[model samples]
Target: MAEQTFDVHVEREFDAPIERVWAAWTTPDDLRAWWGPTGFSCPRAEVDIREGGSIFVTMRAPDEWGGGEYHSVWEITELDEPVLLRYIYRFTDADRNVITPAESGVPAEGIPDEAHHEVLLTAVGDGRTRLEMTEHGYTNEQTRDMSRSGLDQCLDKMAEVVSAQPR
Candidate 1:
């Protein structure tokens, strides 16, 4: 069967340099600080920055959100330092066991088990960076919408973290 596809795209401009923005994405500490939505917290993050590298993170929801940990992994497919990063992302259990969309509470009728995400960063001048992030293969419109909103919240947190850095 041909692969099904849908895309969620977001673009944001930051007042920091491209390198700083790249660091915010590539660095484990920075990722842990802002990788989840406003009410979620990332308590653990492990990253290997290279093509074929793996990134693992645990995002924990608050008690009001059911108080559980969501483990996710990213298998890096492409990398261009401070410029572009691409990967395939999927969910796993605490032990790193793969979790299918249906098992993870996502509608599985059309959605794929994994999604492809790409981030492109450009130095738009004046020490500023423009970030273009796209996640493709969402299959379901509602899932895509929810993901976009959560991603937006995460990026907002990232902006707050990066914007507080020393220039």
Candidate 2:
């Protein structure tokens, strides 16, 4: 398999500089404030914002659906401050426990070393940053279908998080 994957792309024109936008991502407090969809909040977070660092967070819904914990262990493969950040993200529990492919619904055959995840933050003209994030290694048809339905809402939340922040 050619590393089947699903991607979510979000581009927003912010009235902020690239450095400030980068801070929104690298700073733990700023990240927690706007990491998810609108109205959702992260009451807990632990992160080390450096190469080979990790980030763990719990997303809580404002409504009564309750909230589940999810985590991603990232190794900053490439970092060009305020320009780009490339990393591998894996699913995990609230405690930053890694979850295997079987548990993550990804078949072993499709998993690639670069299949975890790739998030690219680029400085588009007009003072905007284009954020492209992808979650790969999920070749299973059912899992992909299920995730597709929820992705837009998730990205919307992420955008909302960014919008709510002050430059």
Candidate 3:
């Protein structure tokens, strides 16, 4: 069988320059204001913003997914100011336990130390920036399907976040 692949790319023109766009991502306070899907607010924000830094955030929506929802903690593996932010993001439970692949029924041995996720930000000049996000690594077709769908929602949320930012 062929190796399964999972990738997602999202792009948009922001009314702000690359510097501001970069700030929106690196600064915890700024990021809290506009991160994740629309209407899902972040009540807590923690970010190291460097190579191997840690980022933990809680996404809260009044009536989203039947109630507030949370995304697993993400570890920053590579950070290049105003350009790249790469990390492994895992989906977890409230207790912070890595949900097992058996639980998801995808033969995942729990979220691995490395999961496929990376963000690329490029300055397109003229005060506009293009953001491309790619999620990699899915050994199975089923897992790839799930990753594709989820990433669509994530990009939609990202569009909202970028649009909401001040120029």
Candidate 4:
């Protein structure tokens, strides 16, 4: 029998150019400005925009959302300027120590040890940019659904951030 796998996908269009949209994602300061859910905040972010690079981000949930910090790292696997980006997401400690989801306050059950993410950017026309994000490797539907919600919220925040950038 085949194993069950779940994935999360979200897409959004912005009024900015592809260059601005790409920079908003790859720049650390821009990431910190709008990396988490609506009520959440990213207090730390470090991005190395190259193949085989790694990114570190610290996200803090609001008091109503458990009020804790979650540290994560994204191991970049592929990169295409202003077009495509791919990485593997994993939890890590503040000091760069790898940790399990349980240690990071993330639900362990139904969550994969490592989630794969792929982001594609396209210029739709008239300086508009379309961003498509996909995250896979979930062990169950519940985890996938949860991630989908988070991703959607993150993009909603991204829309505001990118739209404000000078295009």
Maximum-lDDT candidate: 4
lDDT, model 4, position 13: 93
> Residues 86-154, candidate 1, lDDT per residue (tens digit)?
999998887878898677653466556888999999999998899999999887788788889999999
- Give the runs in model 2 whose Cα sits over 4 Å from its true position: 1-5, 9-12, 61-63, 101-115, 140-155, 158-164
For TM-score, candidate 3 versus 4, the one ahead is: 4
lDDT of 1 at 137: 87
Better of 1 and 2 by TM-score: 1
Ranking by TM-score: 4, 1, 3, 2
Tell me the lDDT of candidate 3. Answer: 0.65
**Candidate 2 local lDDT, residue 38:** 55
Q: Write the per-residue lDDT of candidate 4 for residues 40-121, one digit (tens) a residue.
A: 9999999888999988999999999788999999999999998999999999999968898888887788777788899999
Candidate 3 C-alpha lDDT tens digits along 51-136: 87867766676584555556466778888888888888765555556665444333463224357577778888887788777766
Q: How many backbone clashes does candidate 2 have?
A: 3
Our model 3 lands, by Cα RMSD against the true structure, at 4.0
What's each prediction's TM-score? 0.93, 0.68, 0.71, 0.95
TM-score of 4: 0.95
Window of ten residues with lowest summed lDDT in model 3: 104-113
